[model samples]
Target: MSSTPAPAPAPAPAPVPAPAIADRPPPTFRQKAGFFAMIFGMFMAILDVQIVASSLADIQAGLSASIEEISWVQTSYLIAEVVMIPLSGTLARILSTRVLFSLAALGFTVMSFACSLATSLEAMILARSLQGFFAGAMIPSIFSTAYTMFPRRSMGKVSVVIGLVATMGPTIGPTLGGFITQALGWHWLFNINIIPGLIVAATVWSCIDIDQPEPAYLRGLDVSGLVALATALGTLNYVLEEGPRNDWFEDQTIFRLAVLSAASGCVFFWRAFTYRQPIVDLRAFSDRNFALGCFFSFVVGIGLFGSVYMTPLFLAQVRDYNALDIGIIMMVTGAFQFSVAPLVGTLSGRMDLRLMLAFGFSLFCFALYLNSFLTAESSYWEFFVPQAVRGVSLMFCFVPVNRLALGTLAPDKLKNGAGLYNLMRNLGGALGLAVINTLLVERGAHHLSYLSENLTLSRPEVQAYIDRLAERLGDSLAGGVAGDPELAAMKLLFQLAQREALVMSFNDCLLLIGLTFGAALIVMPLVKKPRD
Candidate 1:
């Protein structure tokens, strides 16, 4: 009967309340120093993604690589980076932030040096792949640290710094690359990382103290899941990057990789859901805001990378601008992006993030719409307003989208969620580029064919155009003599038609990219307004 005295069972233990924004301690100097260093490392990582883009020709010539082989310089990096991005979450947990980030920075630096010394295409590809794997680890770790290290109130400023770095790195990449390649050489592209990389590694290793290494996580490594993930992502990236160039499934290699990617992807997903400790925790998607945020990130990626890719290309192919000229023209976007950072940081605190995101995406769509009017005669001034609008819009989009995606994740979930979030953006960029390339080729051919069909010699306009061109050619020739003036005129006419068709295709691609942002707008309301 005295057992009644033991009653009430010591009422269930109350859960510990999370620290309030005000209650949380400010980041110490060490944390701040470590964070900035990590941010620098992240910039290097992302910048390298496109630094080689503008200077691919130089690398090609340097290594005596064929047109097809030289592309692997970029492709190998992208494929390897994609595989490591999602896997970084697990690695970070097992190794701890300090150890993982330091190792990544050191490894990335060493690989950069190796790349600079590469004497063959094979060596460059191997070095670049290893470099990308290390680079991928640095990127997500910065994102996760930003969320976990700072308090809620400080996120506005923290987001601006991280957002500026993330978006600016890629935006200004080609510009920096072109300058470096033109003034120095392509080898400097990799060489530039050595000094900065060493500093970052040393600083981060000494200063970072975010969390302890979970040796238990290493014990539950999920080896099968890891292999499946690597296979799935690596094959998927290769297929996406090479598919457009290889005529998609028409190439046997692409087709086989596509199948392998699908099968490995299925295995990866199955392991993620059933395994006790998944390599990438799929449960993050169960958060409605995170899911919607990732979609926004994907669309933003299409805008961010697609524009960077297309603008330089149009200038190179249509306007015949060299790397330096294109870099000069591209400076507008980077300049505006820098100017808008402070304003975005201020607005992030006062404005409803959803509204800010809407405004940002609206500007992005408007900018793309402006670009759809591209002509072969278009020059820097023609691109100025659109690029500026895009730059401003990206700052707006990046800050809010990043906050909305990872801001609400629990500390325990932030690392995995950040990895997944970054993976989506990169995937979007890869897929967007593939689709853009395919569209450019197919649409260019269709337009060219149509123009040819309508410009037959039987047409009165065609004959008149030919006669005028012949007369001009004859007048321009030395001693007023021309060899088969009509034949020369025909050749000139075909060249003009080809140029017009290519411009039209560029216009089509820009319009489609704009429509993608428009579609993203439709889904904006599904994102729940974040809690105050």
Candidate 2:
């Protein structure tokens, strides 16, 4: 009676056709230019971190700084970068990409010029720290911009490109630094950055652009978080920078700084989580893949950076290799690493990333253990074996962990992942260097004592060896002469002392690397499969 009219036949349900797969748009020419320019800038920034390796002695001599104080040159830059990493995302949102990158390049160039002119240790440290701030902002920005330029599927190839670009830092840094320091002086180390920085800054300004951040996410800068972070990192660096000279915890000042660092570190992490607007999205931890990848990445960081820092020290100082010679040795491993990047990059997607990582870690542990056996008379080939194996391991490391970290993450989470990755890597490097440096000092002293006791002149073997050396010299048995046996025995004794010292110091460095890699290897099986 209501005359429903059968509800108009309930309009036939609309056909539910299958969803369409959208074709990705091609990259614009401007994008190509910006992407490569950013790659170049990133190369230069990373290069700066290690370029000073060969020039450390010259810089120390030029500035009248001691071995202990000279490390500030490295520490200052590390400290600034550490502080800026968490802030990279926040700053990226606040400023347009083009403006931010250009400003960073400009500031970095200016700071390099300042470094060239620095006449005092303090001045150089300040300049290096300022340069670090700019470099810090640019690294994540470059990675973010480049990765987002293409669709997700294209990330593998892009990662290979980035790994190659990044490899230039360690590969060329020592070689170029050697040539610059030898041909010119240490000052040229800073001066060379000026032209490259300007070229990249102009190129980036013309090519890159990004729209403003969403207003809702644009919270005020977290100054409290900054203060807490700075205090912790800065305090910790103070302890590391001074520990070798101050005798570690025995020094009251270093003790205080260490205490302050631990306390401030805890507080900063707490406030960062509880704040209205956190500096970094610590919630990135909610993703299991990201978190686990980061854990392994950190151990890898300690192995990579610590070895880089310590090996050069031993080569330059202990082995008496000029920077050029050091460059030649390092080239062995660098070449090995460069050749393997593409393979690892491609294979990571197809194979189980965890298996790949575990294999790499195993090789790393084996290499460090081999390196621990180095003596003062060790050949280049002897060291090269372990180093070259590590070089192969590094390829697996540089690409796989990064891809795995981002595997299950959404697009929006990438920037946060990169930032956290950087910060943790730097921290690992700092801890690695700190522990190795401390142990080298302590262990070297202990080994010397043990060797002296075991190899006493009163021992029959040592006395016989001394007599044989004296007899070979064919000089008066009782008196000293230019080539006399008494003088010859003394010389042989001195050589043995030097050998013991070198072996003990290098042993300590290897111990650090071995333990770190071994621990990571043991924990590898715990990383869960892709649940997403």
Candidate 3:
């Protein structure tokens, strides 16, 4: 009994003191330089896609490619990019962040040069796909490092730069490309990456020195999981890109791809849950904040990419603005994002993130509503305010949503979580663009039919408008307007009807976008706030 009492009376161990804030090691100047290089690489990757947008016609001409073949230039790049994004997490783990980032930058640089030198459509597509693959590899690293490389207190500051680069690259790509192409020729668009890419590669290789490779983890590589994930994302991306263009399920290829995507996705998830070391960890979704953050990310992606797609289409198609002018108008949105993102990031440190999300979504919805009023007569001035609102709202949406999703994960899970989080946004963009395209076609047709039905020269108002248009044409054109007045009037009426149909369709699309943002707002409360 005495022995047991003596054993029980062992003294308590001394209390361990928590490390003070000042004791934490800060990032060195070299690491910061490496980060900016990574940002530059990411910027180039995203910007390349947009830069090529304004110059695709020239590319088509230079390669002697058909319109259908030219579309593959973009399709190939996008498909490759999407497939590589999620895999980056696993790749980084195996190769180490430093090596992976350096290789990605180098690969992207070489591909960009190859793209510039491509002599045929096939060559261009191949190079572009390779470029996209490497580019996608760089994206998740930027965000993952924002959380993993830096301290939590500095995340808002880090995110500001990443968000700005991400937001601006696409936002201003067309404009920048237009200028480069105009001054330096289309080949320069790809060649332009040479200097910057070299700089980035050198900086990344020489500077980044943080992550350590786990050779043991590579031994457990999930081959089946990798193939399944690639199949799921690749086929899904193809379906999204081609669905509306091909009338979705009506086209056998799209239908087949969609089925493959679904099956592959099911298999991937099953593997994720059952495998001892699956490539991806689906368990991350079980976190409430991550799940809801992803939900909202998908919604915001719709607004982000959808608006980018829509506004340019509106400017080019409806207003007949040149690529440069369209780019300039869209830059209004980017300008606001660039200026406001830093401020928002600073405020994020001190403010209630939920309230910020609410405000952001509200402002975005209002911008969409404003866009709903667009007409054939709408000009840059008309888009200016809405685009600015949209720019600010983007910063608000991304910063908060990013914090919510990945902020609560364990450090080990950061890479995987970042990959999945980004994948959702890209998928959302793809799906949103598809839906918007389908909507434009379907709604435009519906509006056309309805408008045509009432334009029989039966309505007096219709006749009067046509007569007035004819009179104006007669006054303006030489040789009595070249056709019979009645015939000309009818033709003009049809044109007007078509334009009106397009405007109505766009308005409908914008309204739908607005409603989607509002829905996202409704889901905001599901997220639990993390400590600052």
lDDT of each: 0.90, 0.74, 0.84
Model 3 alpha-carbon drift over 4 Å, by segment? 1-24, 471-483
Kindly indicate the candidate among 2 and 3 with the higher TM-score. Answer: 3
Q: Which lDDT tens digits does candidate 1 get at residues 327-429?
A: 8889899899989999999999999999999999999999999989988899989999999999999999999999999877767777788899999999999
In order of appearance, the predictions have TM-scores of 0.95, 0.88, 0.93
Ranking by TM-score: 1, 3, 2
Pairs with backbone N, CA or C atoms under 3 Å apart (clashes), candidate 3: none
Which prediction has the highest TM-score against the true structure?
1
The CA lDDT at 312 in model 1 is 94
Give the poorly placed runs of model 1, Cα more than 4 Å off: 1-22, 475-482
| lDDT tens readout by residue for model 2, 364-412 | 8888888888777665887798888878877776666766676566555
State residue 254's C-alpha deviation in candidate 1, in Å.
Answer: 0.5
How much is the lDDT of residue 437 in candidate 1? Answer: 95
lDDT sort, best first: 1, 3, 2
Give candidate 3's whole-model lDDT. Answer: 0.84
